[model samples]
Target: MTFRSPFAIPRQLLTGTTSLGGRSAISTRLRCNQRGLATVVPPVTQDATGSKGPTAMVFMNMGGPSTTDEVEDFLSRLFADGDLIPLGRLQSYLGPLIARRRTSKIQKQYADIGGGSPIRKWSEYQCAEMCKLLDKMSPETAPHKPYVAFRYAAPLTETMYEQLFADGFGKGKGGRAVAFTQYPQYSCSTTGSSLNELWKWRNRLEGKRANGGSEPAGTIQWSVIDRWPSHSGLVEAFAQNIEAQLKTYPEEKRDEVVLLFSAHSLPMSVVNRGDPYPAEVAATVHAVMQRLRFKNPYRLCWQSQVGPSAWLGAQTSDTVQEYVKRGQTDLILVPIAFTSDHIETLYELDQEVIHEANNPGVKRAESLNGNPVFIQALADIAHDHLQKGELCSRQMTLRCQGCTSERCLGQKKFFAGQEQASMVI
Candidate 1:
């Protein structure tokens, strides 16, 4: 999915000048209608003389939509990835006119929900909560440091790395080293993007040279925490959410509800290229649903597709419509991809699906937001990863002792070159 940008540049970035709040004021002054986001400085750090500075933990992930104007930018970023879509001649066929027209409707969806996308907010909350959990369970030492660096937005990896370096994450946050990125689930798209960025950052730091015609940069001692698909606790959390949400409906409706599991859709051609995103989510969904063991029928489908490209088959809307055509009333739409309730599960499922599933006969369960069980599961999974050599399901470890790493970034051999700009210096 395309991620929206609230501004030309996020204000939290560490501009080279050390004047306190210098760039921030300039950014705000230069703002216009297009730079529509507020500029708020995050918490800062201090030195021996108590000079205030920055802190780090900029976790990175692809952002979701934020504003109407951002819809196209998000789509461009989404479709730009060959692993996400195969535009073919469709772009030329549909052309910019059609692309804009189609994307306008999608942007309105975000505008309706407040102005910006909720992924950034939800991720920040998750990062904070994850840090809190780590502090509680293990003091004096922490699990891998937590940060939220958006692949498409701020805190961008370079920006956050700069912020953390300034703040003391890695010789930046009080001179203590910082460790970023350890997403529980492994996917080339998510973990892959994070790993490549960190490696580039490290190259710039250590001054490692890029192979091919790429750039040279130092590197960060980033632990490549691979995706953990079968984390039983996390899987069980989904199971519990299904059961909890199902309780809202009477037993009769519960028995008939469709166990619809939804993940962000990728292009059909990209899926053909061996992107395991769909398969990874599916495996997790199946394992979780089996644990839940409801008598209802379930199906996996994709959502938030854009551009003229053909995405995975049976879009959520179409699938829901089909179910309604078949006379099903109660429908439980589980967000297997996201662990929290963001715009997708909220607006998409709530307004869009509720509207599309117009069968006066249909009903949907809200996404499993940061519910108690879900948060607990997240904390437990991280804890399990610490105890076991690899990630452990609530009940068992998914990886054997032989399998130490959590990801498979080199599976396809797509390499990234070092990219360090003077703006960061």
Candidate 2:
């Protein structure tokens, strides 16, 4: 069966499509021969002596604190990020103040959820397992080395980058790395922010000169798998989990159960900027429903909106409360956006939302942490990306309609220009 990507762009239109000052913005850095095609080094499938081992597979996500003790630091870093929170000139002052004020309460939330978030544990496991599969599925890029780069919390992006250098990846030795976003849907505040951070470090550590000079000859070649909202395997995993939850209800009430597809909410400011998250998230929900053959009624709702800003809604908690009050208590809350269990799932959905409803009829489907099906899906996504040798999805080349940040522009140019650096067998 042919699967269509919701963010799909035709291959022919990808190159020379985006421009700045009437010149191709992306391919400017690419080394093209007389024939006008990107010239790359020989593909690293395998040497005659042995396998082409140790391909770096970096999993990128906005991580949570592993213990209550780490909550303050986590919140501080989170609030400090202009990309995620955007506090203007007072960001340095207000970010720490906001974090300090909220730390105690947030710490308690972490305590309530068995000391802290389980994201770190699950992310490491998922990446490692996926790499094990990649070693077999794509032997050309065999011995895929798993690495996790969280935007906030321990094992942060900088720390992960340092490890890559220590592991003999980029200190004047050419290698390949793929930045695989853990978020299935793309969001500037999420995946885009992570990519920006990654690019920042690559420039800082890899000797990109102050005057915008290029890196050393033998540095790491980078590519990204930015978004995969409607992959068949991912849809199947979500559908199976929802079905398992539905089976707990009696046959008479099963068909009547409502599917509440919930994702972390984005601020209206970001939404107005033309962020692709909302549309991509809806794609995941629609694909899952199709996989289930539209067995029951469903609605996509938003959750985990922070601060006083107007956010995307009907909010998940409010949606659950109103439905229970209306005597439609049979509902299944599916966390569609997050691949692994975190505060949103364990504390917010379970502890706060469902607990407040006080109805057993209201339930949450299991998170996709350590689910073999989901892990296999991750491996499948990675294998396909490695085989294709595209720098990133064509969708990544186009910035948000209202984007003005130079960081976003530079990051896009650097990654998109990597067509020349990419290995094609």
List the candidates' TM-scores in order: 0.69, 0.86
How many backbone clashes can be found in candidate 1? Answer: 37
The C-alpha RMSD in Å for every predicted model, in order, reads 10.5, 12.1
Pairs clashing in candidate 2? none
Segments of candidate 1 deviating more than 4 angstroms? 1-58, 65-76, 79-83, 86-103, 143-145, 171-185, 201-206, 209-219, 307-310, 386-425
Cα deviation of 157, candidate 2, in Å: 0.8
Off by over 4 Å in 2: 1-52, 209-214, 418-425
Q: State model 1's lDDT.
A: 0.52
Q: Candidate 2 residues 225-304, lDDT tens each?
A: 99999999999999999999999999999989999999988889999999999999999999999999898999999887
**In angstroms, how far off is 343's CA in candidate 1?**
3.8
Cα lDDT tens digits for candidate 1, 150-204: 5554455555556555434444224332333434455445655555555555545
